[model samples]
Target: MRKILFHLSLILLFSSCISNKRITYLQNLSDSTAIGLEEFIPFAKVDYKYILQPFDIVQIDFASSDPTLVEGFSFQRPMQQGMVGGGGGQGSDPLYMNGYSIDESGMVEIPRIGKVEIGGLTEEAAKNLVQEKINAYFKDDVYVRLRIAGIRYTTLGEFNRVGVQVIYKNRATIFDALANSGETSLLGKKNKMFLIRQYGEGTKIHQINLNDRALLGSPFYFIQPNDILYIEPMKIRQFGSADNLTASLALFGGVFASVLLIVNLVTGGI
Candidate 1:
């Protein structure tokens, strides 16, 4: 009986041991190369510049030598209580409150400039277009700045925390998305990360293998606004029938107890 129990425990332990191949990320690359990792072939020759879309919130700001001239174009709202400003304070700023949502028609109505069609344009292209209009009004002394108000994304499945995240950076990567969501849990399958992206009229899904360095060259490397990232669970997690360590241990314990009871009953004694 002792021997049976010991062997069963050993089997459970060995089954639970996850292979390094399944957990380790960027496994295809070698550290012995003389070139720095940064110098490696840049990811995605496909342009990562996100195009404007309907319902996308955009923040547009103008700076000029004369504050009064551009003041009419800016609007400010009271900062909400408990909402800290980006620079680390409760101080209010006009741009934060004055985000312009792109209408279904892909146009933003400027105060003096009227309606500007920016729907299909990249942020840089939109900026230049807006700058040209601003230039027509103010000549040389003014500068225009434009950006997506926030890079909003959602993470689901096999993550420690899953929710919609709004990142402030203009450019973010898949790694950035994972890091923001408290990173993936132990069961999160690095090789099966899925990126669901909006393309034109419909949506498309792309598989990303985080364990392979070659993923660095994929077009999906940089995350786009409104992207949905779903991290799959390792097969072991499914086989173990538990999403977490405590649950797995409890499940194992219950199975062991059941086997012990069966053994004792068969022998008519402990």
Candidate 2:
């Protein structure tokens, strides 16, 4: 009986040491304070302005009194005609077919407008620059709308669905990305989520704790194009507990052994 008790005590001690405290996010806030806030606090003080980069697709739409005359400025894809008795089919997305790509030289070649340097400029600034150029050609009130084709980001590490995700939106938050990718798995270390961002001539990495409300004020609250989000695996995952099956079996085995030892001691068999 003493031997069985000693083994059970050791099991409990080891289990306590392998706690999930590190995995929990935002441990500083009290449950009451976090849930009692009435008004929604703004996560970001200013709007996130995404800068243009090389290989980014830019879509420009023109609106004016005469739409037909300004059609030359917009991108158009040629419809595939039935050459061998097949009907004409729709082609790829208009944005990809006709959108302008920012070259390595930080310029986008517009039809009849020549190369315009838009790299390193925010989307709003790029739109204004393009609008100014369009005004020179058209005398009428030509409204110009410009935007990035999509916000592309990559997910790595312990995420359940890991790959490059292209979200079409003017603004996307980190939580949006996680939700879109089916949310993080149990093995994902939410406290160690890393956001890798690209800056001029270099890059910066920021660690985020998803469990903490303090992440709301973080600059990385809004994700940018080409950013990489990596969720590290929990430390416990290294010891063959990456999946529920393994953990369950281990737990069952421990309980079974404890039971066997107790029965053997009571029966005077071992």
Candidate 3:
């Protein structure tokens, strides 16, 4: 009877799949840090080349020692926040609506400056180019700051935390995505992960293997806007979904009743 009970308990434990085994596997392998465990990549320190994509909302702010000359422009675009280096002004209320939306022509209309084509320019180049445009109004030494408000990425499957994360730095690494999503479970496809990237025309799906050290240097390692990080479930979720524990419990109860009946019959034998 004890042996039978022990076997039944094992089945129940198996039904709690996708929780235990995956976590245990991940905890054993993953090391949490901004730095990678393998060889260094050039893109690691150097700023990544990023193109402004569609559906992205961006802000551009211009400030000078003399605020009087900047009266004609809208101060609503990129209000100084979350720049690469610290030491800007405090966070103030947005001066206008949520940044400028890229039109179908891939252009943003700035007051007094007209339309600027920014879809193909990297963030750094865009800042310099924008500063050139705004410099005409105020002093030549004016400051131009650019920021994006709608940058985001999503993570799903076999992860501890799975959801959309808003990106501030305009760059996110593979490790950053997983960590932000509560660290993926060990049972998840750690060695093999899927990344979905969205473009103006459509989307592209790329497969990455984390077990390989080259992954640290891969171009896909840096996540872009509208990117999806999906970690596929292991064999456990499949087996767990097939579990019919309720029926098994009923069968065990019925077996216990039958055992009681057989014992009573033998005791009553003449």
The true-versus-predicted C-alpha distance at residue 120 of model 3, in Å, is: 2.2
Error of 2 at 203 (Å): 1.5
Overall lDDT per candidate, in order of appearance: 0.77, 0.74, 0.63
| Candidate 2 per-residue lDDT over residues 92-176, each given as its tens digit | 4445566888999899998878999999899899999998998897778889888998777888888766777767777888987
**Could you give candidate 3's per-residue lDDT for residues 1-270 as a string of tens digits?**
446655765675565434443343223234443444353556554344457775566788767777765566655355545442211222432422457777767788888889888776766777777887877655545678887663467777877756666545655677776666667765576666888886545678889776555566568767787688887866654433223434555565677668656765776683
Off by over 4 Å in 2: 1-35, 46-48, 78-94, 239-270
TM-score of 3: 0.60
- Which segments of model 3 are wrong by more than 4 Å? 1-48, 75-97, 136-141, 185-187, 198-203, 211-214, 239-270
Please name the candidate that would achieve the greatest TM-score relative to the true structure.
1
Ranking by TM-score: 1, 2, 3
How high is each candidate's TM-score?
0.78, 0.75, 0.60
Question: Candidate 1 vs candidate 3: which has greater lDDT?
Answer: 1
Worst 10 residues of 1 by lDDT: 84-93
Off by over 4 Å in 1: 1-13, 29-41, 80-96, 135-141, 235-244, 268-270
The positional error of residue 60 in candidate 3, measured at the CA in angstroms, is 1.2
